[model samples]
Each structure stands twice: as structure tokens, then as C-alpha cells.
Target chain A: MKLEMRDQPGQLVAALQPISAVGGNIIAVIHQRETPAATETLDVQIVLELPEGRLSRLLELLREQGVSVVRIDEERLLYECTLIMIGHLMHTDLSDTVDRIDMTGSAEVTELSLVMPAISSPSSARITIRSTTREEMKKAIRILRSVAEQKDLLIIEPLEGA
Target chain B: MRIAILGFGSVGRGIARAILAKNLDITVTGLADSRSGIIDPAGIDLEAALSRKDNGGPCGSLDVTPADVVAKADYDVLVEVTPTNVDDGEPALGHIRGALRRGKHVVTSNKGPIALAYPELRDLAATNGVFLRYEATVCGAIPLIHAMKEGLAGNTISRLYGVFNGTCNYILTRMAEDGLTYEQALAEARELGYAEADPTYDVEGIDAGIKLVILANTVLDMRTTLDDVERTGITLLTPEALRLAEDQDCTIRLIGEIVPEAGVLRVSPRIIAKSHPLVVEGTLNAVTVETDLAGDLTFIGKGAGSVETASAVIGDLLYIRDRHVQGS
Candidate 1:
């Protein structure tokens, strides 16, 4: 999030205080003090992580702090989970399995590593999925689980932080 | 305290050996195997009975049956360490009911009765003013049930999960370590006596599921059964699948989990980090209890073995002895 605030003594602190107040974790703060001296406005770029549905509240809080929003760059899919699937992957239309999660729009299969040992033996694949939120991640896993069930595949999910 | 023991098998013999090794002040008044039983108002000769059974014979006279020991024995506690019959929990269930009805404390390693019929048995114990304990039913020697029921009594347990089955753990450990296929690892486990000839119960997640049901019903105060568990076993696990987990510095383990609040009971092969406390080696078992007050507590110990399981049973017996029994 980029903000334009008064070029005053406590303006940057005021702008950053609202980020924490809204439960946003500030990753980086680029204060551009070298902006042209013609305008009495300071431009600060903040890279932050906010819990879902807090962006609008954060923007309102920033506005209340007399900070005008310049631009907001949103990285939606921040949550990821990796799982292992074992079965006849190629024969079971693996693309469709990946497509189900991708079609959700809130989640997508980000990476996959597959191993086919023999022509007749079961194949194995490691799938990494990214979702916009933890709830979406769970929904993504449920979709994958159902697809795996239909395919008669074994899905080995992570024990924690899945 | 004088006690009667039913099913003189590995666990029974282990209890007998522990009793002989230590002067724990426990008196075995009655003992029975499938075909025979011995009853003595005075303590039974455990050493002689052990030797007799070691020679491929019954533990005692065929004239006395296990039912006779349950009904007629003069004892304060009943150690029901019979083989688990998951179907209906069989004679072990009847024996447990008999002991509780006779106003006796009951400790068992049998998963069947506890998993299938804990509520009725618990009420029976309460009505009879006796204690019913089955610490050995899950995770062998971890003292998990005691810890949950006594140590962390007041705290709320939000989640409980870990590697509950040793046979599956052994197979997964072998598969991950040596890059062995499921078949090869299971064969090695069977040869090592970690798994039975028919490995379906252990490998199909039924054993872990049953343990989950037992914990859910007994400790977590959840009404759950084996069918309620969403189960996935290690049978279809491949060396390639293990390799994928290993490549990321993780390994696969059969984890049994119960979330009381969410009403979740599941036993499945999970990909856990190698550095996880629950990622125990060989046949070791580990459980992590997520409690509200004390945070998370992880317990690691031998999941199976005659002596290890007997440790749980003896703990339960001594618990009853210290509190309820009249004299040591």
C-alpha cells in the first residue's frame, strides 16, 4: 500500500500506527524523503500482510489518519499446502484433478512433481496448492480429497499448517 | 491387592514377570488362559504357570475356565488383558461387566470393550463404586490416559493426535529409511513380530481408528465409534511417495487425531517433518496433546511390547491400589 501524507514531523509514524491497529504486519516501509520538494506531501510505500477482509477496514483507518491512499497491490494467494498423491495418476486424468482446484479462483495448484515407476505400477505425485486464505486452502484440500477418492488415489496431507 | 488375571498371553505373562521382578505387593489370586485357569485364595504360583505356558501347554487346569475366574475368584481387581475382539468385544466384555458388578476394580489392555462399550462400563463402574482403567489400550506405555484424566485434569484439550500404531509406524519407518516398498517393509515387520500374519487390521488403519475411538469416548468426552473415523492407511504408500516426502526433509507417519470440538476423528498416513517430535523411530509411539492452559505436551515412548504394555496395566492397577483398594 502506498500512501501520501503531510510532510510533517509525525506523519510517517501516524500512517504506520494505523497498519498495526488494523492487525496488519508491516514487512517493509519505503519512506521516500527524496521526493520533489515542490509538494508538501510525503509518499510512503508499505508492504504488509493483513488477515482476510481487513483491507477495507485498514484503508478506512488510514484515511482517518489523514493519509490518502495512492495505490494498493494485493497478493491474494498467500496460503499454501503441499500433499502427496499416489495412484495411477496419468490414467486418472490428473489434469482434471488439478483443474478442480484452479477453477475455484481462490485457489490453484501451484506446483507438481510426479514419478511413474513402471507402466503398470501406481504413480506418485507431489502437489503444492496456493490459496487466498486458510479457509480456501481447506476447501481446496476437500476438493482434492474428493477427486482422489473418485480416482482411488491415496492423498497424504501434511500434519500441521495444512 | 489380590487380583484375578484373564487371558494368560504375552501381556499376562509380562505382568506376571513384572510382578515377580518387583515386590509391588500385587497378589495374583486367579489366572486363566483360553483352555485353563488356576484359582487360589493364596497368591498363585506365577513362575510355575509361566514355565508351563512357555512349554506350549495351558497355564493351568482345564477344569477351571476364565468364566470361573471372573465369577468365583476372591480378588479386588480384575486384570482383563485378553485379545481384543473388535466385533463385539466378546468374553472380555462379559468379564469386565462381571468384575464391575462384583464391585471390583478393572484394568485392561483390550481395546475392544473400551472402544465399543466404554459408556455403559463406565456407568457400571460408577454405580458399583469401582474404578475402570485401560491405560494400555492406547499408545502402550505413554501413560496418556492417566495424564489426560489426572495430570491435566482442569485444562481443556482442543486436539489430540500422534502416531498411535506401532506396526504402521515400523512399516513407514522402514519404507522411508531404506526406500523399501510397502510389501517389503510389511514383510520385514511381520518377520520382526511387529505385525501379525494378517496385517489388515494394523495396515488398514482400523487399529489406529479403534484407539481414536477409545480416546474420544473415554477421555475427550466425545461419542464416537470406529465408523466415525475418516481413515486412510499405509498400504498404498510407495517408496516414491516416501521419497517425495523425504526430499522435503519430511517423513510419513500414521497419525491418529481427534478434535473434540470439531467432532473430528481420523487416522491417516500424514506427511510430517522429520524433526517433528511425533516422528519417532522404529516401533516407538508419540502423542501431542494441545491443551488450553499448559500449551502442547508431547509424549514419546514404546508403543508396543509385552513389558511396555504391562507398564500401562500395572500403572492402572497401582493407581487403583493406592486410592481405592483397602491395603497394599
Candidate 2:
């Protein structure tokens, strides 16, 4: 089977540690040299042969680390993440808002934007962020809202609408 | 499954290389060109054929011509990688039509025929209950066709636009960074194997326009024509103009767009902000698609070159072969 791991400085070595600890043989790794994921990481497509029984535990161990594992099909949880932020995105700062959300140790911001116009803008910005899991994403959003509030911006929490 | 390759050019040779490397459930029955088609059901000497081309006895000398090979052979797959004509769009249309008539599954990297006759050719394939896929017709290895056809199938595509032409993008990139004159940039592109010597189709935006039509058909299910879409080439760009745009933090690229709004289709170019994700650099091509559900999805990759394009064509072949085996 194949898996894509986000390339951090120590990530390639760290990813293999869990597999080696559980007994897995690495086959080939196709690293797209020029193209890297947004997290300043390269995409490493690793072919591996692992023991059938230990595959589940191996995946659990990998997830326990702060690795952005994209594909794992044998026996693992399908991770999903969502975040909602409230702030004066138009007035405060757009990049700063993204930076704060990304600063959270767990989830990285996959998509975001501020809806204000170029000339005249509202004092508040609604930002949506996606990550790997709901809990980690919620914590990231909380940190983002705190930053927004400190910058004198309003933070809007996710709410069910009519 | 038995497959035969015609016109052992860049595309054909690349496909042969991939099939050998992947060791997929496929066997190359024969390879043919203008000289002769070679039939080796057990698998032809791919390396030998490539070496022959490199040494230059014939452009492609398998053992027979495409017509003779298809007429006398019992092959299930026929891959046509002939030269693409800008005006007539001949060889591609003839070969594909003939293959479909013969009940053979056809895959092509030729854009001339598919861009002009997508609906008609697709209907012909459906009527015969055979597959006709041309993933290489658009952006080389970008997978834009399948990305729209399968990946984002659930959303309603409202707008489709991108840096579809690598040649034009390459020219613009040089012109922007080096402050090269349009002529200098074009000359550099021609020398660098990015632009053809003539470069009429690429520079006139006709090539990208055709790709836009194909993308519209797949992404929005809208039937658009090359003449229907408005096109503007980068030939008229001046260093002063590019500089002005750069000052505005915008890069000028020859972009192809298809916007289907309330049953109306509009295709043209506009200067977008430099920070726009679609504003990719160099020979790299990027596409930004807006879907109702998926919001905005972006894809970037090598948009041209024989090997990259051949990879896409072979991908379609593997997919078709898979379906055929599964169905049977």
C-alpha cells in the first residue's frame, strides 16, 4: 500500500519510526521535489509492506504524532476538520488571521479569505478553516478568535441558522 | 488486454515506457508508424524501437502502417499519436473514426479532433459500446478533465479559467522577469523546446481556446466552440505594459476562461491580482474552478511536453482496460 506524508524537516524520519517500531518494510518513496504542500512540507508517497495485525496500531501511533498523514486505507480513522472564526478581518489583518489559526499545533489552514471590498470594508470578517479533526480544529479556531478579540475585532462562533 | 500503438513518436514511446514500468495488466501487441507496424503480442522491444528513433532510420518503424496494422490485426486497444493539424485537424479524426468503426477502444493524445468534435466522437464511441478517452487533449498531466468529471462531480460549476497554455505562460514569464521583448521571449521559448518554431496556434491563443472548449464540456457540461470563445494572445504585450501591470502587483498571462451563467457562456481574459493562486510562475499551469459545493479548487502541474502528455493518455488506457477486464 501507499501513503502520502507531509514533509517536515524530521517528518520523513519520524514517520518511518512508527512503522519500524511496528515492523514495516519501506519499498519506494516518490518525493515531488518542486511541489510541496502548503505547510512548508513536501509530499512523500511511500510504498510499504506491513504486518497485517500491526497495521492498525502503526496508524494509531503515527496519528499520535503531529504528522499530516493524507491517505491510510487499511484500518484507520478518516480524519475531518472544520473551524469558524469571527473578527474584523477587513480592518485588522488578513495574513495575521491566517497565521494565528495556523499557529495552532494541531490543524493547518487549508482555505481562507476575507470578504471585504478593496476600498470600503466592514469591521468584521468571517473565516472558515479546515483541518484534520473537529476537536483540534475547534481549539485552533478558539485561538484565532482570541487573537481577533485582542485586535478589537468581533468573533462569530458557528451557529445553526434558520 | 492487447493494445497496439501507432506513430511511435514522443507520445507512443512514453506510453510504452510507462506500461513497462508499471507492469500493469496490459500487453503491447504491436507498434506502427508511417514505415511499418510491428506486431509483438508478447511485448515488442520498446528499448530497441526507441533506440531506432534516436538513431533515425525512420521516425517510427515498428513493422507496418497504421491502416494495415488495424485492418489485419486483432487488437482491442488502438492508441493514435499522430501530428495535430491546426487548420484541417485531419489524421486524428481519420484514425479515431476508423478505429471506432472497427469496434476497437481508442485513446488519443491528439487535441485537434477531440476539441472540435467531442460530442460527435463521444456519441460514436457510445453507439459502438466502446471507450474513447483523451485525457491528454487538455493540460498534459494535470488531470483537469477527470478532476472535473469525477473529483468534483457533485458541484455545479459556474466558472472555469486557468493558465492553459504553457508556451504562452513561458513567454510571459520570461517577458516579465527578464524584461525581454516579445520577440526575444518568443525566440527563447522556441530555443528552449517550449514553443514550436512556427508557434501560430499557441501564440494566437487558438490552442488554449480549444482546450477551454473541452474543459467547458467536461466541467460545466456546456458545449462551446473555438469560435464562440473570445481569445487574446500575449503577442501584443510590451515591456512597458507588463511593467505597469507588475507595478499593480499583477502578472499578465494568456488565460482561457469559460463562465456559464444562466445558460450563457463567456470566455476571455482579465488581469488578476498577483497573489491569486492561479498566478503561477514559469511553465507551470494552474486552474481555478468555482463550484457551488466545493467552493474553489485549484490544480497545478506540468501542462505540456510529450512525456507528461503521454502519462495522461496512458492513465486513460489503464482506466479503460480496468473497466473492460472487470466487466468481462
Candidate 3:
């Protein structure tokens, strides 16, 4: 279930609690806070398996909790990889790096987190990208490396099978 | 597939005709009307029964009763087109409970039973592993129910509002377009068989309110009753009030709305601009479902008619058939 929830405390928890209450097995959850379209609503893509014909009930539960589900992508993603980039991430235009990978239409950086340890020091981010196939994921990693190298950012390569 | 129809009214007869005319692969094993009932486990001859009823005769030969259809008929699905009784949802509600308890799929065009006991029947159907469908309950021929349930599958509907009652819409349209008073337009509607002799049900917004309750419960998963809807009908509207709306490029429409975020459901006569989708002309049902992904989708179609409603009923039947086929 892909949901668009208001970016606030407990919104993501409110969205996931219904899935759990409905006995859904949470396979993966890709919550990208920065990719929300226009509205500041957080974009949540969740993968889970439940009893057939239970999606509608879960959706209603989300609605009852004031969370707006944007879509339910039934297709399952087969390959996922998490990478960490360490450098002046914001100065290098992070959105451009994510957009280039997402524009490929097969792979997307569905989750991202940024942390700045000090005021003037470099900022690092962890990005989890997924695609329909392992080959597509490799292409995305290549794109990420190329983009990071061009921006003079150091890439801590993804751990094998991590 | 063997089926039993619990009502032999115009809507029921229309469904029979559609089943035959469309060459659907199903058999009517039993049919019961207000006055008489028919039963034939080997499949009833629909043409002969229809002809007999048309000639002012009992639907079946002397022996059968409605109770026999509910109890003895050997069928898989029960189609209930019985008269709506909103107060208690009796008879229809009783028949529906019987069918579901017997592990039979039930399809109904009655609104009262649904408006009153939707959650109960839904749980009953789920527990029994049978389907209970009521597409024709709200806006007949509009395919509104299926659109909300299946067509708009993944969309998270934020707000849903629409013009559901054709009788009210017709009266308002005639009054606005032809400069007629409410009573004058209502008489015209009665002449056209749109309004009943006791038009309280249509004019006082009860009909639309009942439908709003059904939609809120079924589509939005809100366990609401007809009483939960704050209803205000069109009997109080005057030509001057309409003219005042027209001066502002608006028209009066009976709108049933549900704001899920606010946890509110209401049916009232409101002034909407002529350009609005709900500003449909004469006896049409229009609904808009606002969603996060699909944006807003507007659907408009005939709200009443034997054949039109039969379309919705048979559509539900075919959906059940296809789902079972795929399941197996």
C-alpha cells in the first residue's frame, strides 16, 4: 500500500498500525519524506501480504485514522540495496542525484536519511534504492556512484546482500 | 448457475428479461412476488411465468409460497428485489438473513435492509463465505457502487459527494428551467411516475439520505445508519430562492456528501454553480470521488428505470460469477 500521509509525528505509525492490525506481514516499507509531491505529505510505499480481499479494509482503516493512501502497488519489488553517501550532500544538490536514478523508471531511491554531525562539517545520507530486478539495481548503483563522483562526494559502497 | 429471485416486481422482471436477453448462463429456479410464489428446482420457465404474471395471474401454479422459495429452493444465489421497508427492513431483511445463513450468495436492490443492517449482513456474508451485493440500492444504472468498490480500487477517497436522487433532481430541474413551483413540478413528476402519491420519501430527502447511509457504510467502511445522515429536503425551495442562486450562476441540487476526515455525512439542498458536475439536468445521478492518486473522477448515469436498475443487478451477478470462476 502506497500512502500519502501528513508529515507529522505518529503519521507513519498510524499508517502501519492498521496493516499490523489486519494481520499483514510487513515485508518492506519505503518511506521517502523528501519526495512528497507539492504537499508536504510523506510518501509511504509499503509491501505486505495479507489475506486476499483485505486491502480495502486496510485502506478504510487508514482513512479512518486520517491517513490518505495514494496508491496500492500490488507488484512486488525483487531487488533492494542501501547505500551511504558521505560528503557535502546538500551543496551537491541531492534531489538531482535522486531524480536521475528515479527517472530510469525501473529503480528508485525510495528511502533517504540525512544527518549533519556539526555545523560546518560534511553531511552524510543513507539511501535505500529498489528495482524490479538485480540488474536494474546494479544500474542504479552505477548511476549513484557516477553522480557521487561528479559531485566530489565519497561513496561508502553498499555492503554485499545488505 | 441456479438462482432464486425473491421479488417479481418490475425490477425483478427486468432482471429476468436481461438474463434471457443477454443469454447469461444462469437459471432461475424460483421466483416470488408479493401475492404469489413459483418454485421449480429444474429451472423455472421464465417466459411462461412472465407471461402468466403479465396476464394478471399468479406468477406460479397454486401450490408454492415465498417461504418455500426461502427454505426449499435448491439454488446457489438469492436475488432479493423486495419492497424497501426502512423502519425495520423486515421481510427483505428476513429473506436476506435466511439466504446468507443458508450459505447462499445474496444480491439485493433494496436500500432499507442495507441502510439498516449493512455491517451485520457483511459480517454474516464473511462468516458464511458468501457474497452480498447491492449495487442497485443507491443510484440505479449509474454503476456507482462497482466504481467505488472495484474500478477505483487503490485510491484513498478523501471526500465523496453527489446528486443521488433523480426524483428530487428532476423536480428541482423542472422548477428552475420552466419556472414552475415546487408543487407544480412535483405533480409533473408524479404524472411521470417519478414521485409517489405520498412523495414524502422523495421530497423530504429520506430516499437520498438512506442511499447516503448505504454508501458511507459500504464504500467508506463507516458503520452509519439513515438516522446518522443530517437530511434536509427540497420542499422548502422557492423559485425566488432559485432565482437568487441563478443570479450568482448557481443552481439548487440535492447533494449527499461524506467528509471522512471530518467524520460527517449529510444530505441537503445546496446551491452549486451550473458548471459543477453535480449540476446535471433532469433525473440523472452524478457523483464525484476525490482521491489522492486519481484526483477527482465524476460519474453520471440514469438513476432509475426497470432496465437501468436491472443493469446494475445483473452487473453484480456477473461480477460474482467471474470472481468464483477465477477463484476455482
Candidate 4:
């Protein structure tokens, strides 16, 4: 996010404090003091990672701090879960399984590693799914589970918080 | 305290051995196997019964039956260590009901009667002014039911889950440790007496599912049965699936979980981090109970074995003897 605030000593600190308050981690801050001295506004660019649904609160906090947000670039998908699916992966239309998750719009199959041993034996694959929120991740898993059931596949999900 | 024991299987024999080895001040007045039974107002000779069972013979005379011991035995407590019949929880169920009606305290390691008819049996026990304790039904030596009922009585339990089946745990542990296929590991388990010849009950997640139903219905105040559980077994799990979990420092174990708030009872192969407390190795069972006041408590112990299960039964027996029994 790029911020425009008054050219003051404490304005930079004021802009950065709201990031931590909203439980965000500031990755890098690109601030240049060599802006032309004609205008009283200073431009500072910040790279941050905020938890899902905190971006709006962060913007409100920044506005309260008398800071103007020029531009915001968002990374929507922040939650990732990995699961292993075992069955005849190739025979069961694996691409269709991946397509079902991608069709949810809020979650997508990001990475997959497949191992097919032989022609007649069952195969295994590890699927990594990224979702915009935890709830969406759960929904994605539900869809995958239904698909696995239709295909007679085994899905092993992570135990934590499931 | 005088007690009558039914079922001369491994669990019943283990309890007899413990009583004989220790001066627990308890007398067994009646004993029975499936075919025979013995009843004496004075204590029965447990040493003789043990030798008789070991020699491929009925523990007592063939004419005497288990129902006779339940009805006519002179005992304050009836120990029902019979095998579980999940369909109707019969014989054990009938035996427990008879003991409770006679105003006798009941201690059982059988999952059938408790899981299938906990509420009815509980009300009967309360009406008759007796205690119904089943500590060895779920995890063998963990004393989970006792802890939840006695030690953590006031706390509200929200979630309870764990590795409930030792046979599945042993298979998964071997699969991850030695890179054995599911069939090979299960074969090895059968050879080592960890699994039965027909391992369907254990490997298909029904065993874990039944245990979950027992916990949910008995402790969590949830009305559920084996059919209510969402189950998935490890039979279809490939070695590659385990390897995939291994790449991320995780392994798959059959986990049985219950969330009372969400009305969830699930048994499936779940990927767990190696560092997690519930990730017990081999035939060990681990359970974590999340409560409102006391936070989370995890219990790990030997889930199954002759003496281990006997330990849980003895704990329940002594608990009854201390609080309810008139004299030792």
C-alpha cells in the first residue's frame, strides 16, 4: 500500500503503527525523502501481509491516523491446506477434480504432485489448495471430499482444527 | 467386597489373575464362561479356575450357565467383561440389566451394553441405587471415563478426540516407519497378534467409530450411535500417500473425534504432525479433551492388552468399593 501523509517527523511512525495494530506484518517499507519539497505531502510505500478480512479494518485505521491511501494491491488467497488423495488418479478424471475446486472462485488448486506406480495399481497425489479465507478452505475440502467419494478415492486431511 | 465375573476371555482371566496376585480384599463368588459357570457363596478358587481355563476346558461345570450366575450369585458387584455385540448389545445387555435390577453395582469392560443403551441403563442404575461404571470400554488403561466423571466433573468438555484403535495405529506406525505397504503392514500385524485374521472390524474404522459413539453418548451428553459417525478407513491408503504426508513432517493415523457443539463424530485417517501429543506410536492410544475451565488435557497409554485392560477394570472396581461398597 502507498500512503500520502504530511511531511512531519512522527507521520511515518503513525502510518506504521496501524499495520501491527491490525495484526499485519510489514514486510518492507520503501520511503524516499528526496521527493520535491514543493508539496507538504510525503509518499511512503509499504509491503505488508495482513490476515484475511483485516484489510478493511487496516484502511479504516489508516484513515483515522490522518493518512491518505493512494493505492492498494491485495493478495486474496492467504490460507493454504495440503491433503493426499489415493486412488486410480488418472482413470478417475483428475483434471476434473482440480477443476471443481477452481470453479469455487474463492479457492483454487495451486500445486499438485502425482505418483502413478503401475498400470493396474492405485496411484497417489498430494494436492495443495489456497483459499481466500479459512471458511472457503473448508468449503473447498468439502467439495473435494464429495468428489473423492464419487471416484472411490481416499482423502487424508490435516488433523489440526478440522 | 464380593463380585461375580462373567466371561472367561482374556479380560476376565486378567482380572482374576490380578485379584489372586494382590490382596485387594475382594472376593469373587461367581464365575462363568460361555459354556459353563460356577457359583459359591464363599469365594471361588480363582487359581483353580485359571488352570482349568488354560487346559482347554470350561472354567466350571457345563450345566451351570451365565444367566444363573447373574441371577443367583452372591455378590455386591457384577463384573461384565463379555465381548461386545454392537447390533443389539445383547447377552451383556441382559446381564447388566439383571445386575442393575437386583440393586447390585455393575462394572463392565464391554462396549456393547454401554454404547447401545447408556441412558436407559444409567436411569435404571440410579433408580435402583447402584453405580454403573465402565472404565475399560474405550481406552484400555487411560481411565478417561473416570477422569471426565470424577476428577474433571465441573468442567464443560467441548471437544474430545484421539487414536482409539490400536490395530489401525500399529498399521499406520509400521507403514510410516518401515515404508511397508498397507497389506504388508497389516499382515505383519496379524502375525504379531496385533490384528485379527478377519481384520475388518479394526481396519475398517468401525472399532474407532464405536468407541467414539461410546464416548459421545456416555460423557459428552450427546445422543449418538455407530451409524451417526462419519467413517473412513486406511485400507485404501497407499504407501505413496504416507510418503506424501512424510515429506511435510506429518504422518497419518486413524483419529476419532467428537465435537459436541457441532454434532460431529468422525473417524478417519488424518495427517498429524509428528510433534503433536496425539501422535502416539505403535499400539498406544492418545486422547485430548478440551474443556472450558481446565483448558486441554491429553492422555496417552497402552490402549489394548490383557493386563492393561484389567487395570482399568480394577480401577473401577476399587472406586466402587471405596465409595459405595459397605465393607472391604
10 residues in a row with least lDDT, candidate 4 chain B: B319-328
DockQ, each predicted model: 0.83, 0.01, 0.01, 0.80
Winner by DockQ:
1
For all predicted structures, in order, the TM-scores are: 0.93, 0.64, 0.66, 0.92
DockQ winner between candidates 2 and 4: 4
Q: What share of the true interface contacts does each candidate keep?
A: 0.87, 0.00, 0.00, 0.84
Candidate 2 chain A, poorest ten consecutive residues by summed lDDT = A153-162
lDDT by residue for model 4 over A62-137, one digit each (tens)? 9999999999986757789999999988999999999999999999999999989788999999999999878999
Worst 10 residues of 1 chain A by lDDT: A31-40
Expressed as tens digits, the lDDT of each residue in B119-197 for candidate 2 is 8888989988899888888888998888888888888888777888888888888888988978999999888888888
Cα deviation of B284, candidate 4, in Å: 0.5
- In candidate 1 the C-alpha lDDT for residue B195 amounts to 93
Candidate 4 lDDT, tens digit per residue, B1-328? 9999999998999999999999899899999999999999889999999999999999999989999999999999999998888889989999999999999999999999998999999999999999999999999999998899878999999999899999999999999998999999999999999999899999998989989998898888999989999999889988888898899899999999999999999999998998899999999999999999999999999988888999999999999998889964
Candidate 3 C-alpha lDDT tens digits along A1-162? 678878889988988999989887898898776664678778888888775567789888999999987777755666777655667778889999999999999899888877665667666566778886677888988898789779976554321332
Candidate 4's C-alpha runs over 4 A off are A2-8, A17-76
Per-prediction interface RMSD in Å: 0.4, 16.6, 28.5, 0.7
lDDT of each: 0.93, 0.71, 0.83, 0.93
> lDDT, candidate 1, residue A88?
95
Worst 10 residues of 2 chain B by lDDT: B262-271
